[model samples]
Target: MGGNATVAVEATTNRPSSASIVQTLGGGSGIDTSALVQSLVDAQFESRNAALAKREETLTAQISAAATHKSNITGFSTALSTLSRSGNLATQPTSSNSGIVNVTRLSGAVLTDVNARVEVRQLAAAQTASTAPVTDKAAPVGQGTLTLTFGTASVADGAMSAFMPGAGASVDIIIDASNSSLQGIAAAINARNAGVTASILTDSAGSRLVIKGGSGEARAFTLEATETPGEEGLSALNIGIGASGTTIGSAAADAIVAIDGVAIKRDSNTIADLVPGVKLDLVSAQIGVPVNIGKTLPTNALLQAVSDFVDTYNEVFAALNKDLDPVTGSLKQDIAAKALKRQLQQLTLAPLASGAGGAPTTLSQIGVRTNRDGSITLDSTALSRALVNSPDAVEKMFAAPSGAATTGNGLAAALGAIAAEAANTTRGLGASEISYTKAKSDIATDKTDALAKADALRTRMTRQFASMDAKVAAYKSTQTFIENQVKAWNSQD
Candidate 1:
């Protein structure tokens, strides 16, 4: 053996060189293969994932902004409708003496300023009759068929003088064993509804069978009783042309009222058709005295509505500006949101109605003025002056929502129409929100796909690096054995 011996292994047949293994494996150099594979996969899709995440954030913000814009306009329209239905825009009526007559304006009725002098001379009277008092109220009166006939009657000195039968079948009142008593007969007449009523009047003495007909001359009725063979008590209630004992009652007359010294006659005291929109609810007779019914203005309600309009209009205007901002807004690119600004301006500017030559015809004329910031301000003094000068014109300028559906007339109608259009799902604010939501969903799908690709890349790299790791361990073992053998050879030498 030689004095010093050394052996080196250069087994590079079908593999990488030793230098390449050291650089690739980093076995004793604290290099991790799993971490390296993950870094590679991240690098592959980092830029794409970042872009998708930013798009998702933007779409979510846009959806929120569109919803907010729709909510603001919808709230404004709802408030306007509420103000209209509160009757703040109508003219209230006032009665001088409510005890004599009470006056009220009907809903949706156009009422003029009427200070009419109304007088109720005499209330309408109905023809009434009463039978003689009897000893017992529940005792059987008779069993007969009492016939009633309607007619036009003539009165001479508060008594029936002549009668002409009207064209109709006579109404029959059946008096049988089932309804033979006074109380039973009254109930039978009520059930018939034959333009007359029957009742039993009982007092300290006895009970009397009283019958009354409706008011007016044409409502006067005649009774004809045909008694059975044994029941003759039914004949006591008979009153007509051929009555043996019963006498006819006084004539029924219509009510009499005077307006402008012109007497008016009607069947009822509650006169409505005489005046176009005025209803005179007569309570008592005032032969010559007249009560005045005048038109009154609701100043407080008008002022409150004006104040509320200003507040709500300002809120909607502010929301429009922010949502339609060209730069920082989330819904800046939405066409429906952008159109609201101009629509709001036009609605506030348009005239609700045409007034008198010198009267206010528009909201601005009554002092709902716009500011530089696209909001509105209320000038109460101008409105007060307009109301004082021409109350009718002021009322015509702001028409409220009316009818069963509460649809607006002028400004309310206009605002509601535009709000409804903007909120339409097919091509408006609703559509914008839908589009944004769909885009966000698409972004989620893209992010998932990108992550999947990255994971697959990581899996491929992990397998490839595992093979290299195993080879590095084998090469290190071979290198260690060669080195140990060389040292033993030197010792042997």
Candidate 2:
């Protein structure tokens, strides 16, 4: 119906249409004209579309390769930076008698060798005060304020101090009938945290309340008691030197040690300041024994760091060298690829800054040499001797002070710079890969446009075919009617 309307509209307007001329129908003309038109369209468009698809595939492969190359190079640069920093170096610590006193190195703490005689006279002790044995552990001792004061007190007088000078703020523990038992008083005293710990001690004799201070000279204390008129039993908890109600532990004393014949008194057994970069822990009283302490370069740590740097350097070069392979990589013919490989190779072989006092300048001089495959190999024996003889020179070679790029900044620094450049996202290979991806995207857009035009042409051809079919059907109907009329006229004659 719509096709008839289109033809009727054109006839009413007296305008000629593209399909105005009548053509024979498929059965009448003995031809499959619609199928022929579709075949022609396919022949016109398929080859160009296949070529565009191939171009997109090639571009995508190259972009992926570039991405992988950038990742490997960046990893190499990060590892190189670890080798350039001086803080990464390890310090070796040794003690002549580890059983006597154990030592450990602290982070960021520089240790140096020192010859010293350590004499441990005594270990620091805490002040402990104990109440006299009581028959009932749960019975209330008193109900009042138990005042604790800290100051220097003589152990002989039933009061004791820690190894350090007395230092404590006065604290008060309140005792009441509700919580005045040995266990209750201990809990109350502990809850105050007034520079002391409290516990109920049970022995064969009876139960007793004990309060102990820290193991330092600054922890001396005196305990006094005041009781309410009805709670005068609390006074039994009072503690002092020679006090009848309480017994004091051994006198608190400072740890005493002599290093190199210089006497030193510390508030605790863990002594760290007697010698520079050396800590002496007084385990037992050995008044005249000398313990030797030594510090050396941490050879194992140095070896591992150097090994990692070398291995990572080889990995970066391997990624670049693969481009030279004929069949595997897309970069085989790329000039940038060759230049990158050459840059890293030259940097690895370049000599580092000379040592402070005429040491080896090149990595090869210290037992790390280039292999036939362009990777480096290390000789541990040679490196160890070099380290022993000229340790300062070896360090300067890798971690020289900041100066001119060609003169002072070490080989590690130079290699790091090249790696950074190759992997730089803003202007390096990563950026180049991004451009490649964009180009690939443009090719995709072009293919899409070409395919869309082909589809549009198909739509136009279908509509034209439909109009021509309508005209052909109408002409066939007209010819059939005229032939029947001619036959009727002959019959009538």
- Winning model by lDDT: 1
Off by over 4 Å in 1: 1-30, 37-50, 122-255, 267-270, 401-409, 447-458, 474-493
- Kindly list the per-residue Cα lDDT of model 1 for residues 1-493, writing each as its tens digit: 2222222223422345444432455453346876787788888888898899889889988888888878888888877766665667777777788888777676555566576777888777788766777889789989999899888776554345577888967999889998899899889888999998988888987888788889886788778788988887888777555554444455677888787667888887677865556777778779888877788776677777778888988877787787677888777788888777777876656766556577766778888898888888989999888788877766754456454331224567677777787789987788888888998989988988888888888777766775677566656756776687789879999
- How good is model 2 by TM-score? 0.66
Worst window of 10 by summed lDDT in candidate 1: 1-10
Worst 10 residues of 2 by lDDT: 20-29
In model 2, the runs with Cα more than 4 Å from the true position are: 1-89, 110-112, 130-143, 156-168, 173-194, 199-210, 232-236, 244-246, 320-355, 359-365, 369-374, 379-382, 392-493
Residue 376, model 2: lDDT of 73
Clashing pairs in 1: none
Over 197-276, each residue of candidate 2 has an lDDT whose tens digit, in order, gives: 98888989999898888776556677778887876787777776445788787555677777777777787888777656
What is the Å distance of residue 475 in model 2 from its true position? 5.2
Best by TM-score: 1
Residue 398 in candidate 2 has what lDDT? 57
lDDT of 1: 0.75
